[model samples]
Target: MNKKWRWTIGISSVVIVLVVLTIIKIGTTQGAKPDWYSAWASAASSLIALIALVAAAVAANATIQTNKTQTRQLAKLEETQQSDRASKFAVWRALHPTRDSQIYRTFFHNAGPLPMYDVIIHYFVNGHEYTSKEETLPPTSTPELVKKSDNNLEWFIKKLAIEEYGLYQPKTKEEVAAIADLKKRAEAENVRIELVRAINEGKNRYVKDIRIETGVSFSDGENTWYRAPNGRLERTS
Candidate 1:
């Protein structure tokens, strides 16, 4: 089963055959074997030994090549695993409502070790898709805040509360109904969001399994940004 045992068996078989042939030659010549017969048998034994050596060399070379291939495959697998581990990103949201003012401050946080780039949070409302403006969210140690009202919710609230005269005031019955319907649509849809980062060579990384309540729409003159998942801002790609 092993190389040593196989070599031992092959060599023993060859030696046994040589001894048997020698004995036969010597017997047929009545204990005085012809020189040519001995020479032919020696040549045959040498040829067999050479064949065994070549076979062993071939087997050893094949084994070495196989080991090299396996080593390279293992190294590649480890590299892929390390890349996955280092590139993982997670998005988190926290609601910090001020008790006195009833100002609902919703903070979107990046919870992973890696920095997230072009982190567009996508939300679904009544089967329609909306996305947050592409932004970079640094790692957990350096949290970024999103002013929900200024950036997102207040627009809807203002359009509803303000009359045609443009004075800011409380919402009328119809406005209240519209706001309630919007809230219902948002909650009913559950607003699944995607946080994505695109990189050089068109490679993309996404923060998986996190959901947010709202999505943003980018205006015509918005800025696009990029960053490496593990490091500082990447100015290109």
Candidate 2:
């Protein structure tokens, strides 16, 4: 029972005891009835009515509070259920042939319980951005089911070297001499091999000076969400 109900019951018991004592005193009196006796009886009746009203109000308030608590719990449960499956959609990266392979590829995988719609991926490599979209991506439990992108790490780095660093294939003797001079400067500066290979092919040149980041936005038919590169997921709509 509620604390207010307990207080109400205690007050009602005390008032009943006082009213019983007053009635007993009236019954025991001998000659002229005391004027205060009628006043005490009327006051007792009024006190009982007031206690009843207070008890009723307390009961109603408790009911309202209980309902509010239940409503909040139900809303929380519904939200958890809706996001459970969508949260499992993720972007994964792996190197082809082996983990130490120079060629790295990005893939879209839905380990979620449900299929995602309007799946869009954004890739950022050293500030250069690329976007790709798909109509739907289905959930999968195996690696073979994951979808790969054509724009891999090797492609992105090569593009960056050509566009940002102004590295290109030499067709003339002058252009070739310029590349040789650039390579000498690069070697003196201890530049990373991946950048060097972007200008001219070399062995064991891996992706360096390239920072890759990915983000994804998709839907579960009812709601939309976005997942950042750091794996933080949030609802967009």
* Leading candidate by lDDT: 2
The residue-by-residue lDDT of candidate 2 on 118-193, one tens digit each, is 8887787667787667668888786532344444445555655666556653344443445557767555434434
In candidate 1, what are the lDDT values of residues 48-127, reduced to their tens digit? 67767866876787698789999999998976554442333433344555656443343544544555555665443233
lDDT of all predictions? 0.47, 0.69
Model 2 residue pairs with clashes = none
Worst 10 residues of 1 by lDDT: 195-204
TM-score list, all predictions: 0.36, 0.65
RMSD of 1: 14.9
Candidate 1: stretches off by over 4 Å: 1-31, 34-61, 64-78, 81-86, 92-114, 124-126, 142-237
> Stretches of candidate 2 above 4 Å error?
1-33, 94-103, 127-129, 143-157, 168-206
Q: What TM-score does model 2 achieve against the real structure?
A: 0.65
